[model samples]
Every structure is written in structure tokens, then in C-alpha cells.
Target: MAANVEDFKKRLDEQDLHIRESWVAAMKARIVRGELIKCQRGEGVNHYKHCRDLAEMYTGMIRENKVKGYKIIDTE
Candidate 1:
């Protein structure tokens, strides 16, 4: 029963991760398509300074959905 519950929880987490990943992809697409400006109008390395908001949001999402490393076992 505990294994079943763990599997169910893992499934739910995977679904949430998928939804978050989709959102991130859409945001990236908009930025790439120029529909959403990700940085200020400038021509220097400092241009990234204007993108702190977007960067922070992206980082937050990634950090929130981060998964721990797990080893895969091969049973032949």
C-alpha cells in the first residue's frame, strides 16, 4: 500500500512538473518570437540586469520543481 501511495504521489508531482515546464516553454517562445521583451533596450552585458524579474521567476520555478538524483536499476 505504501508503494502504491508513493507511486501515486510521484505521478502527481510529474503532472505538476509538466504543467510548469509547459508554462516555462511558452514564456521562452514568446520571448524568442519578440512578443515579450525579456530585457531592456541596451547593447551591453548589463542588458541582463533588466531581466532580473524574468530570471528570478524562471529560477524559482526550476528550483521549486527540482528533483533529487535517483539511480536506475537494471533487472534482467
Candidate 2:
């Protein structure tokens, strides 16, 4: 029983890590696709907004994946 519990916990941790990596990958893809605008100005409010939007999208993706029982592991 203890071993099964440990395994479950490890799986959960791995899933969380996978989700985070997925978020990073999604954000990178969005940047590559020009969905996220480049900040010509310095690190201003627009830059912050862009980053926040990317993060929110990532979070949404994570939630969606979890609901589907899919682990989002990053290959790159």
C-alpha cells in the first residue's frame, strides 16, 4: 500500500512537471508564431501584459490537458 501511494505521488509530481514544460513550449510556439508581439520599447507595461497573457494561455492549456487525462511532456 505504501509503495502504491509513493508511486502515485511520483506520478503526480511528474505530471506537474510535464504541465509546466508544456506551458513553456506553448508560450515559445506562440512567440514563434507571432501571436505574442515583440516589445520595441523597453520592458514596459505592454511587455508585462504580453507575458501575462502567455502565462494565462499556458494555464488554460494545462487545465485542459488535466481534464483530458493527458500528460503534457515537452519534447523540446
Model 2 clash pairs? none
Q: lDDT by residue for model 2 over 1-76, one digit each (tens)?
A: 9999999999999888877866776666556335434442444666666566755665565454432234457799
> TM-score for model 1?
0.42
State every prediction's TM-score relative to the real structure.
Answer: 0.42, 0.43
TM-score of 2: 0.43
* Model 1 RMSD vs true structure: 7.7
- Residue-level lDDT tens digits of model 1 in 1-76: 9999999999888878777776776666455434214354442476567666666665665555444333347798
lDDT of 2: 0.61
Off by over 4 Å in 2: 35-76
Candidate 1 CA-lDDT value:
0.60
**Residue 76 alpha-carbon offset, candidate 2, angstroms:** 27
The Cα local distance difference test for each model comes to 0.60, 0.61
Minimal lDDT window, size 10, model 2: 32-41
Best by lDDT: 2
